[model samples]
Target: MVLPIVKLVILLARQITRPVVHRLGALAKRNRTFRSVIVPIGQGYHSMNFTSQSRLFGVDTQTQAEPLSTDEAMNLGSKLLGEVLVYGVSASFLLYEYHKSSRKEKIKAKNRQNEKAELQGKIQEYWDVTEAEIALLKRKIFELEVKNHS
Candidate 1:
């Protein structure tokens, strides 16, 4: 019973790693960058079995493209450089607007401080005069009511 179970586990392990083995095989086959010591010396390849090769190099299949040429690489670089310049100019404009708004905020806050100082003394004088008049009227009304009751 244990022997059968061990065999089954071994088969599962092989199934799991099979894809990884095939991908490494395909990458070494296609890209020169990874072709160094991993592939055996002088072991030539037969044509790729279609399913595995399609799965491995899905986008780069004969339909879409061949490898990039030198001219293509140069064109791609120039396009990227133009995009960088546009982004730099946009960023500078945004930074200038941000500083302008911050300066306006500082000026507004200074004006508010001056207005508060100008109004505070006038407001305090009004409140004091109003309170004194209200107290005198209340005392006069109380005295008149007391005399009428007596």
Candidate 2:
């Protein structure tokens, strides 16, 4: 009861705060880079959680550099080369994490199969006993027919 209520309150607060945060961010002069975290909600549904972190070097924050002219910014498609490096590193990390998660998923599926096979083996004795009883019943019926004929 309490947990659901708490979750609802939190959800409401987050909903209310999000727009204000976005408005504040849009007003800021600095460039913004974004990345989203994907959360699976089961049955093919997914939700994204966004976390905004600003990059500020200690001395650079205090020193205001002149904004780049359009041509300068375009030529530095490198965007200080740091942005490219950051993106490269982040992409590599995301790829590695995805591979690890896929490996874990394969392992989980294999374990589930092993568990189901183990359970089937446990119940096998019942079928084995039933088959043996069926064979015995057939032999007894054959003997009874011989007796009847005699």
Candidate 3:
């Protein structure tokens, strides 16, 4: 259930971010400064992907930085925006589910209270009937005793 909802939220976020990603690509193509900044970040990302991450081997590898292609910049932008959107959507969904569950629990508690009240009323009625029968029997016994003694 949670997995499907999360998948749906991610898909929706991706769809919503598509236009913005395209715009970022266009901006990267037109702007040299933007490319300079974004490309280095992309280069760092690329180096991390290609390079060995283990430091225990004491392997010191130097990575060459390359300019990011427009497509790469656009993809990076898309990923960033998509993740943010997904987080926001997922959080909102969780909060809504929490509130819904809270309401259901409250309703369940109220029902339990009602049932308890009804049972209490029934028990009180039974005790009342028992007391009334005891009183009548005692009076009959007293009258029979008085007749015999007389």
Candidate 4:
């Protein structure tokens, strides 16, 4: 029946289009780029009770434990601080570079747009002049015909 044929056509169309659509969506999502900082915090602190404050990738993580000695807490704090500083600095540099590149691209795009607009205007002016010249020639031809007829 025609209905079956139509259904088969529709199914085939969907199968043909689905992968292309999915790929385009993935590409679009990939193009939306952003810089993020990821710091790995181990599970050791989760099981322990200690009052320690440390910075991790520009984030402050505090855990409170009454049983841990001062020396032990200081050691852990120093380790965490070192890790955080290293990761944070790297993240900052990466973010700075990304922003710099984005700015440069924007400036380049603006310049290109300006150039395109100027070129378009010039083309339009050229067309206008050509049209006027054609109109003038047609008018002259009409005048000549009138004179010949007289």
Candidate 5:
């Protein structure tokens, strides 16, 4: 019975956390940190494959003919370069926005803390004034009693 409950709790926790974790992972993957590594490695592998298959087998052979024309290659490279530039700019913007949001949250938290402290100080002051008033009333009553006795 306890085992089933534990499993259920774990499942619920995963369900709740999965979306947040996935989003963060996606963001990281899209960032420059991952791009610098993934882009070069991917390009290198693609180039190696293309070279081995196209150049190693000669141009006269039908099995290993030239894959792309000069114009085609230039167009493809330009398109890829454009895509990388766009992605880089967008990722940088995302990072900047993330930092801005975090800063705003910190400021909000600090303001809340200050407000709470001020409220606590006001409560303490109220209690102190109330105690002083009670003390004064007690003193007045004692003086009246002494006068009546006299």
Candidate 6:
């Protein structure tokens, strides 16, 4: 259950991010300064996903690499922390909105049900009144018939 909810959140996040990514890419293409700043950072992030870099974080690999310097470590840590915080906040906001909309839908459904029941009750009342009127007319016709026969 938790896994499915997490997957749903991730799916929603991807849907939301795709458009923003496209717009940012277009902006970066049009702006040279932005391009200069973003391109290298993008490249570096892309490169970090490789198996070679995976070894740096103690993943199983034969090649031995030097540990990061203090400044590099600090920068990496802060960037990671920033990313975690951003994603956490985004997920929280999405969950809140989802909850709110679902609550509203529930309320709407309940109101519709109540209205349906009320309408049914009104129809029944009308049917009863019509039946009573028909019975009264029948009794009046019987009395007129008796008078005519006498």
Maximum-TM-score candidate: 3
Give a tens-digit lDDT track for model 3, residues 27-58.
Answer: 77688877666566556666565565534355
Candidate 5 displacement at residue 56 in angstroms: 27
The candidates, ranked best first by TM-score, are: 3, 6, 4, 5, 2, 1
For residues 1-150, write the lDDT of model 2, one tens digit per residue: 899987886576556555544443333223433211111111112111111111222332333344444333322332323344444655787799999999999999999999999889877977899899999999999999999999
RMSD of 4: 18.3
Candidate with more favorable, higher lDDT: 3 or 5? 3
Question: In candidate 6, which residue ranges exceed 4 Å CA deviation?
Answer: 1-48, 52-67, 146-150
Question: Which of 3 and 4 is the better model by lDDT?
Answer: 3
lDDT of each: 0.57, 0.51, 0.72, 0.57, 0.63, 0.68
RMSD of 5: 14.8
lDDT of 3 at 38: 59
lDDT of 5 by residue, 1-150 (tens): 899987886576556554544443354356756445445544554565676767666743335323454334333433454445555665787799999999999999999999999999999999999999999999999999999999
Q: Candidate 2: where are CA atoms >4 Å away?
A: 1-80, 119-126
lDDT of 1: 0.57
lDDT of 4 by residue, 7-84 (tens): 886576556555544453344334432101111121244223222333424433554433434334333433444445
Query: Model 2: which residue pairs collide?
Result: none
List the pairs of residues colliding in candidate 5.
none
Per-candidate RMSD vs. true structure? 21.6, 16.6, 5.3, 18.3, 14.8, 10.8
Q: Judging by TM-score, tell me the better candidate of 1 and 4.
A: 4
Tell me how far the alpha carbon of residue 57 in candidate 2 is from the true structure, in angstroms, after superposition: 38
TM-score of each: 0.40, 0.41, 0.55, 0.52, 0.48, 0.53
